[model samples]
Target: MRVSQTNLAGDLLLNLEKQGAGPLHERVKRALRLAIREGRVEVGTVLPPSRQLAADLGCSRWAVTEAYGQLVAEGYLEARSGSATRVRWSNAPDTDVARPSARQAPAARFDLAPGLPDLRAFPRRRWADAVRAQVTQAEFTELGYPPAGGHLRLRRLLAEYLGRSRGVSTTAQDVTVCTSVTDGVRRMCHILRAQGITAVGCEEPGWTRLRQVIHAAGLEPVPIRMDHGGLRIDDLAGRPGLRAVLTAPAHQFPLGTVLVPERRAALLDWARGVDGVVLEDDYDAEFRYDRRPVAAVQGMDPSRVVLFKSLSKTLSPALGIGWVVAPPRWTRQLHQTDQVVAQPSTVDQLAFAALLESGTYDRHLRACRQRYRQRRDTLVQALADQLPGAPISGIAAGLHLILELPATVDTAAVVAAAAARSLRVADLAAYHATDARAAHGLVLGYGNLADSGLQEAVRHLRGAIEGSS
Candidate 1:
């Protein structure tokens, strides 16, 4: 019995092409196993005869037969003498595996959690086009195992984009592409460790992941506090043996205070004085709604500063494509560590580069800015009308803004109340790394929410605050 066509399970499409890294027979076995595991290939479904499958795949019959034999032995499929192979795998996972249980949190009705962009505004059509173009027109070399650094076209394009847009002084030779901001920072920490730097200073109320990444690289992350002027450079004098600093100078995280001019100059001077390196995170600097844009700290002194940015907030976090502009000394170090720590695939890199070249990425950013601006405006007005004189900070820019409740209101109480009501709002203390807490407030993100949505969210949040009192 010959089955010439590829097997299809109802309306489910099987991507025989996604035969991920392995030998041919193993790839075939893995794909079929996944289909069964995912319930696409239902139990008791008979697989195509090996000879027919081989002819359809343009492979030898023996390969298909061997793959089927292995799957049968693994208990994913059952085969008998003179019988067609049938799926044995079930949709339900095995209860025998002692998996740790976690209490699932209630889903928020209106989530204004910071550090996330409006996913609804994601340019799906443009992104899909970019992917299609990449797969169709990418060079044959790009289809093979990607180089340690990244795809050369993407590296060159990113170098150009960052230099022109962010004033980052870098060339393709100096850039290293990784999966995320933390990945880039982790890589830099390892490089800094090699430079005899044992400890680094990070903003006290900074990105929580920064400290974790720093610790993972076997370096101590000293908590450096920030005022309205951004990270306190004077505090650096107290931390002994600290030679590196991680900062979001353009628009500080959670707090949203841009590093003042004096502190910016002082930071560079301190770096020069101590021969220290500054790891600058350029996360969401593109969405400054007010005030003049601050140039990247890396632009001030590229030799001493490493710049990191990702498409997470700008485009989508799902892409997981981030770049690092390291100085010449550190650029070479990436290659050394990258061998032990594997890098992301070249497929998405090509797609991103296509978006960059066609200017689709920039257009998407402009549209998102407008949509988010309206949402932000709606939330601000609602907050002003409902709870006048509420201390709202970090509103001048970024997808999220900070709303400081009266000190009388217990931050935890409001959070619990909000959770109980299915309204998700994050507190400022959550961003603090040290034992000392920062300002107590809700970090409200309006990017993913609509103008109508914000009115409802603010109402729920205000109720939470009132309930706390």
Candidate 2:
């Protein structure tokens, strides 16, 4: 067998030929596996057809097929019923090896799936430093039950930070820290329900988890459509018994449309007119790519808008540190809810406060924003090159983009094909409350993938979409 290697600038190449190996299939299988493991055949890449690849390597198609079959069995390759074989992204053994019944293993290779940050870049050293400093200098009573709201230092820092960055005017007294946005929304709904508001107007294609939370709290969710500028405000002009509305005005979840100035004013006007509350989930406002982020609606009408933001998208969700700044009217009720369900960790709050105060948090946000913008551009270009006819949307901000496919393509089928290739992705249709009139597509998240990984993932994504179509 003759094996040759070429060192390309960005990619490695391995050429294998069968010589005196016991069997051609065995030789090809070993070579393919080596190429994949050694970064030759990168993850989320489509392998050549059995015949073409065999011909290139001077081997029989049977040998290539057999080798591919073996690789598939070992989770390195994926074979669709009628589609060509491709390298499985999930075959990377480092992160996807062990499985616990309770939790699913991470995806094999390029996880373009949405709602995750770059896990590799977490600031462990800085956090550890803060933890050590807090432990050494803290009062003995710091570890006790947290204040009904949250850590005073964090609250004060967040008050100033949110005002400057997100334009949410508030005092530390109005800020109530919770475990996550989900917890905050649930508590807000409970407070509203108690106030005799049995229904909340939710965005039609809003975060599914928020819908569940509202439903679980015995509140009916009235669906309102969203457009490029923001939510369809006219739909909720005079709805009765609608006590509140949950909206992601900063960047509408999944769709990524910034609420325009007119709609923002209209939403606040509605709330003021109806004496209703608006739970503004200001998720990912700081990661805007095109323009400076629009101010929070809370700033326009703080009395009616309960603003929520967290480190989930900015820093990491695992930090479990988020806060809701409501008007003084609802502060007491929110505090009572926090007391009953428990507040976020004191240690995490203190550590985050230190990060924010020391400017580490701002620096991290700037770095991530730059990196994510590049990644987003890479994915967009790849999709344009591969799926040229597809209508692309939501590329302006945030970590993900929505690629709208033709009506002839089955979204569910594409999702299954992606899964078969061990490439995790989310179907855009899945995020809608009702059937959407737009073409189907997948939401691709580039935040987690490095430059190489982003390109490869988009390549594999194109192959999967093409194969399914």
Residue pairs of candidate 1 with colliding backbone atoms: 118-448
lDDT (CA) for every model shown? Answer: 0.82, 0.81
Estimate TM-scores for all models. 0.78, 0.78
**Root-mean-square deviation per candidate:** 8.6, 15.5
The clash count of every prediction, one per candidate, is 1, 3
- The number of the candidate with the highest TM-score is 1
Root-mean-square deviation of Cα positions for candidate 1 versus the true structure, in angstroms? 8.6
Q: Least lDDT summed over 10 consecutive residues: which range in candidate 1?
A: 95-104
The lDDT of model 1 is 0.82
lDDT of 1 by residue, 190-227 (tens): 88898899998999898888898899889998989999
* Top candidate, metric lDDT: 1
Q: Candidate 2 versus the native: TM-score?
A: 0.78
State the lDDT at 206 in candidate 2: 75
